[model samples]
Target: MSDRHMICPPKHVAIIMDGNGRWAKARGLPRSMGHRKGVEAVRETVRAAGDLGISYLTLYAFSSENWSRPEAEVNDLMGLLKAFIRRDLAELHRENVRIRIIGDRTNLRGDIMPLLLEAEETTRNNTGITLLIAFNYGARDEMVRAMRRLAAEVAAGTMSPDDITPARVSASLDTSGIPDPDLILRTSGEERLSNFLLWQAAYSELMFLPELWPDFTRETLIHAIERFQRRERRFGGVTAPSLAVGS
Candidate 1:
């Protein structure tokens, strides 16, 4: 590991990239401009994560609720997504960053689905940091979908209801192969999870930053990570007696 990553760095970091619209509004610019700038931040953060030796970085790019946005705004967001993949895919592949998508793909628009699939397929063999994009994703929806799959197994006599453990449920979710996030950061001073990774973030150290998504830079990411390293994660257990009480 590099000296820069010697701190107790998190193995997986998930970010809720928020406040793009607010960022644009504050600057008297169009929301599309904010979104475009946010994409640049995404590229920067990915490079920073790789440099820091972080294994997984999940980005909450778009939620299922975002579909309710105005038609033109939604179109703009989709166009940005397409443009990002087309422009950055080869570079990401060359950098050995594997792309993974964790979200509902059932009813995705025909044009958008192929781009997403291509990103995954092209980078499937990469050995570097895995970039998980949560598009059209909602925590509740993910849980419900996982439960439905388990329920079907029970009905089919392949698994018993009594065998339904937390591990089983986690394995059934869209993030089956991915590790749960060790830290979750939400930009724009948001202090809530906002329906993100509810099941997987049971013990994630959360950092709510005042910076908008478009303003998130490598330094901001490092600061959040340093904050996470300062936290003592007990994961429901108490620390050792020597470490528990203050001396």
Candidate 2:
């Protein structure tokens, strides 16, 4: 590690991988090809995260809104996801990396659900970096689901509305055990959260890059972290006295 990387690394990092269709369009290739290449980016980013000593890495793989796409495209995405898990699960497990899926799994296709469950179950005891794939996820939907859990408890007389603190609500979330991402990054130069980790990104440093997902590299990851380390995160508090002139 160089002195450049000696800065404190964030405990959790999340990425919104975007622009697959655009990448394919620009390359005159099928969108499916872009998605396949994006999978390669995913593998590289995961390895980069581990090398950077990040404890949790969350990837916005598939959103609930993504189901609205054409059936063929959706199937292609599903197939790619399955291929990734089946091909890489063993290697990831051997690396002592724990796999976690954070999203709505209740309505997943029969074939996809088992693979996700198996991935999690297989590496449940690993004591290393956690890779959280957010498939079928939308931040609003996540919050809604978390709210429903609390509401059900209230209805059952196990809790009251007044007891619903931020901490309590967080515990009801799908990412209950995971820390909030300290850095949230998006690709393709898009500057939007796009319903990813809204609840969990209260204080995350956001970064947007111009590179398409398929073109992402470890160098991009390093550059982002270098930028992240230069930020002075106060988390909505004053860390020191104001030094502004004429204050």
Candidate 3:
């Protein structure tokens, strides 16, 4: 591919890893197998993002709505999460990747909380690309939580309703301190956000690819980066005069 996009790589790239079940169904395999394969894709994508110089890579691993899935599948997912951290945490740490978990952690499974904390604590000081895992996360819930915090503050006389600016609201969310994603991608040809990063994705370049999560590779990521580089992010404003159509 072209080296031009490499010169100006996006600082953050977020992905909604979709179509694991469909992928498995297409091959007449158990859905669990698709999730396992998706984990492999996660590993490769993490490594690739670092190599590509992307500063932050946020992955939508589990959504709050995922709780409604079958008990067996939920258990399988929990097991896979535990296994991934146990098996890959050290290598991720060694590579200087900083692990950050977003979403509501207050109600996570009994055995899962410690592992997630360990992953974050272990990599807290790393200076490399931040790998954010969006587990049990929903954008609307994030907003509600943030709003409650502000409302409480206002009611308690700490601040007025006027203090509820966009910046304050943003800082109160789970992704506080992290910049918004430059590109939001979903595989399986899905065009919707599915409640992923609604607030943060306001100006992101949306990309939908036909590949399932299990089929994602470094090359796929590179192509997404190239696509992002080609976008004209006006951010609700006009472009600079130098590039005007009739200039």
Candidates in order have lDDT scores of 0.92, 0.92, 0.94
lDDT string for model 1 (1-247, tens) is 3335455568999999998999999999999999999999999999989988899999998999999999999999999999999999999999999999998999887689999999999999999999999999999999999999999999999999999999999999889988999999999997999889999999888889999999999889888888888888899997778766664
lDDT of 1 at 178: 89
Q: After superposition, how far is residue 79 of candidate 2 from its true place, in Å?
A: 0.3
List the candidate numbers ranked by lDDT, top first.
Answer: 3, 1, 2
* Alpha-carbon TM-score of each model against the true structure: 0.95, 0.95, 0.95
Task: Write down the worst ten-residue block by lDDT for model 2.
Answer: 1-10
The residue pairs found clashing in candidate 2 are none
lDDT of 3 at 123: 100
What's the residue-level lDDT of 115 in candidate 1?
A: 93
Local accuracy of candidate 3 as per-residue lDDT tens digits, 115-199: 9999999999999999999999999999999999999999999999998999999999999999999999999997999999999
Using lDDT as the measure, name the better of candidate 2 and candidate 3.
Answer: 3
Q: Which 10-residue window of candidate 1 scores lowest in summed lDDT?
A: 1-10
